[model samples]
Target: MANNQTLIPVAEPVIGDKELAYVTECLKTGWISSLGKYVTTFENRFADYCNTQYGVATFNGTVALHLLAAALNLGPGDEIIMPSLTFVATANAIQYTGATPVFVDSEYGSWNIDPAVVEAAITPRTKAIIAVHLYGHPADMDPLREIAQAHNLLLLEDAAEAHGACYKGQRVGGLSDAAIFSFYGNKIMTTGEGGIIITNDQALSERAFFLENQGRYSDNPYWHPEVAFNYRMTNIQAAVGVAQLERIADLITIRQRNAAYYNQRLAEIDGLTLPPNQDWAENVYWMYSVLLDDTLPLNRDELRQKLRAANIDTRPFFYPVHQLPMYDTKQSLPVAEDLSRRGINLPSGATLTIAQVDYVCDELIKILT
Candidate 1:
């Protein structure tokens, strides 16, 4: 989607020469399937980058989450806590394990899962906390970790959107018991479509790898030990991942740069709230998200429509999981609901030039002011 098209896209991948060369190598060697050198290399590279000990590559992030859930043996009578404001996949992954997803409200400062609310939600059956690094800002993990320790519960990160984002001084994927990341086409980095489980826990890492590969041992390929999934990432995908990882720093820097420019320009719009940049967190600004306060003449959807007319694409924040049909618990989470109503993701992608951003800002100013 990141191309020189007429419409400025909300997000796009930045593919380069290295990606093509690596992919070509996979094709030339007939190692297009999951069995190839790129898979292990990519896994090790990503794990090292995250300061973690292991990485189990998967076809996508959702399965990586489900894989972890299975490895942990979560099932009925267990509950997992997470913010209501995140994408529904977080809740679905828990549901896949037959575990209930206990929803919590978001904190105003980071628009992330609230630690105080998480503590309150814990019960005898509560098994873990899935702290999502929303939009690119890390959740305040220290308090959450404390609560988890106090309750004897595991803490995990759903860092699909916050690759390279830092909490305090550490990167997100290495901050918990285990974390997962999405390498989707529109993410900060891309492998076309892929994901991985990163962690320092030897037992959990071994379990995840075992479960992802149909639960069969290499020495006994003919014997099926347990029912599992074929969640392996393709060699081609890992090849792309390796190339993307090679220049991950540059991608992160560009996002932060774009965010800074957006902040300087769009900050002029009085009621538009800038994305969070905490003193202890390094936000990668994946989407350059902003919230539309009542002071603006147009609501979020209306402004999005006008931006559409101007050939600029944008995305509204996700509806809280509790509000969605599958998980409609009738539980009132005021902060998550409010942020979902007001937040919007602007054109934050590799293909978006400074000139395109200027056009977006000009259009917003003309329409809102």
Candidate 2:
């Protein structure tokens, strides 16, 4: 066994020689700022990879969401429906546009926003639905698309955790009207801190570009037409992102292999529920999250404590957004509430070795048994 003091983290970005070379070139060329060829190159390449027509690079994922909201012209009295079992950024992005975020429960099977509940949550004030691909599994998009079309509601995808995931043979980023991706240090891919908005609509793409770059109708200096944001991604970040994108397939394979190793070893254990992979979905396993059944001898937090003592880092799932103090609502979402209390994310970085995965599963089995 590795030393007990050698902590295995829940996630880590894989930075290699190509990333170093790219960033070093950026530094040597003094193109480290927001304006450079690397930024445009990375945007085009990433958008193409996701089968989108255009990409608008941003300072970070949250800002990308905010940019999308701005492009859609969401404002006061408007509503955007989203799952409560998600990172706070999803809700926060909607609120940024002066729109109210309506919380919906997650489905237990996929841990994504429930389409049935989504329809029920919509009111006359609803203008959009943010379908978050939680934990790298694509949400049931076909039904959501149908609902969006029927109601004339815009369907936007929060694909931050689902870089290479697919549903019904289409990539997550292309399944909706538009999508946003995060390149945070711990994501499947990394740019230190950057994000991009992808869309097939040309007008929406142009609008996002205009909004992110201070609302300049043209690149000409000192000509602002409307209120906008300074949410541009730095060239240094894009350099890293380009290198990361080059190896995205390999990185995803490594994560999936590690997850498989854990699944095989941990399957026999009782009181543990493995992450779900629906028949129509290709899960990228952003983090190999599992739920501890309520009947387990130890609860999720208790298990996390045991793992921590053994130098194994684990993370609890997000607290349902509706329950958070800032957006506190009396709405009771049973599935999201139950899953939040029991779910835990294991060590699932792309660079994690089979032996390391075995160690984590062994430690978890020991704690549960």
Candidate 3:
């Protein structure tokens, strides 16, 4: 243990002088509300970047999902097919719209929702399928879209963890009827706390805007309208988002390089599995996950403890949502259950250095081997 050594973090947001100066300018401009210039500018820029017609900014990623559910008119009689291998926010958003989230297992290759299972889950009441591109790996979109089309279900992409990811030469955020992105502090891109919904449908985009700003559609501020939640992103947050967007290319590059190092070093280790990406995907890994097979000398939790003892931070894969106390609805899933037990997220952030990645991989390999 040395005082000179800096701890490598599992996820860290890189906030620099640009963000600071932008925030200071926002404060001085007295346009810190949801209607500020930066908010409008950020929306336009992000929409253009994604090659979509519209982008509506929200307070955070969850709000974006909730708005998407509402925009699609998903309700009490509706059901959503999605993976249990995602953050609870994915399920919670569907729940907010009074729709049931039918959880499915993860794909063996990409660790995203298995499109095969999503098709099998389709029913008369299934109104949507939320395809989450987990950990910056673009979920196989074409097959999922085909399934949704067959069932006449809406297709939504929860690209919150995949800001710069692409699939089959198309960007993640513009792939579905509606796609949502998060600008949470820990994501590949950050606005401290913000999100956006992108779509090519004019009606859906307008409805999302209305829902995001409290369901008001009038130009007059004093006009009252139907009930809607307050999910608007402030000008201050948009200002920061604009700065982050400007640097997304560089951030993605850093993430790719760090992920490559982790994959190369950890791939050869017995019983250790790296995050999987398909050939068509340009992965911008938000977190580097390594699976520790049970056949290994130590289980997942034990290895985490061993790594932590060496001052290395790691996170086990999310506890499958179906296994959570609230979601114990007797859903039978074998793959998600197994992957959840074996997966571990290594330190992967835009600010991470090669030396830090090497340190993490070396320590992990040392323990696992």
Winning model by lDDT: 2
lDDT of 1: 0.92
Give the TM-score of each candidate: 0.98, 0.99, 0.97
lDDT of 1 by residue, 48-113 (tens): 999999999999999999999999999999999999999888999999989999999998899999
Tens-place lDDT per residue, model 2, 1-369, is 454668999898899999999999999999989999999999999999999999999989999999999999998999999999999999998898899999999998799999988899889999999999999988999899999999999999999999999998888999889999999999999999999999999999999999998888665857987889999999999999999999999999999998888889999899889998999999999989999998889888888899999999999999999999999998999999999999999999997888888888788878887
Once fitted onto the true fold, the runs of candidate 3 whose alpha carbons sit more than 4 angstroms away are: 1-4
Q: Candidate 2: misplaced stretches above 4 Å?
A: 1-3
- Residue 32 lDDT (model 1): 100
lDDT of each: 0.92, 0.93, 0.87
Candidate 1 ranges beyond 4 A from true positions: 1-5
Backbone steric clashes in candidate 2, count: 0
Residue-wise lDDT of candidate 3 within 131-152, one digit each (tens)? 8998899999999989888878
Clashes of each: 0, 0, 0
* Native-to-model Cα distance after best TM-score fit, residue 176 in candidate 3, in Å: 0.6
lDDT minimum window of 10 residues, candidate 2: 1-10
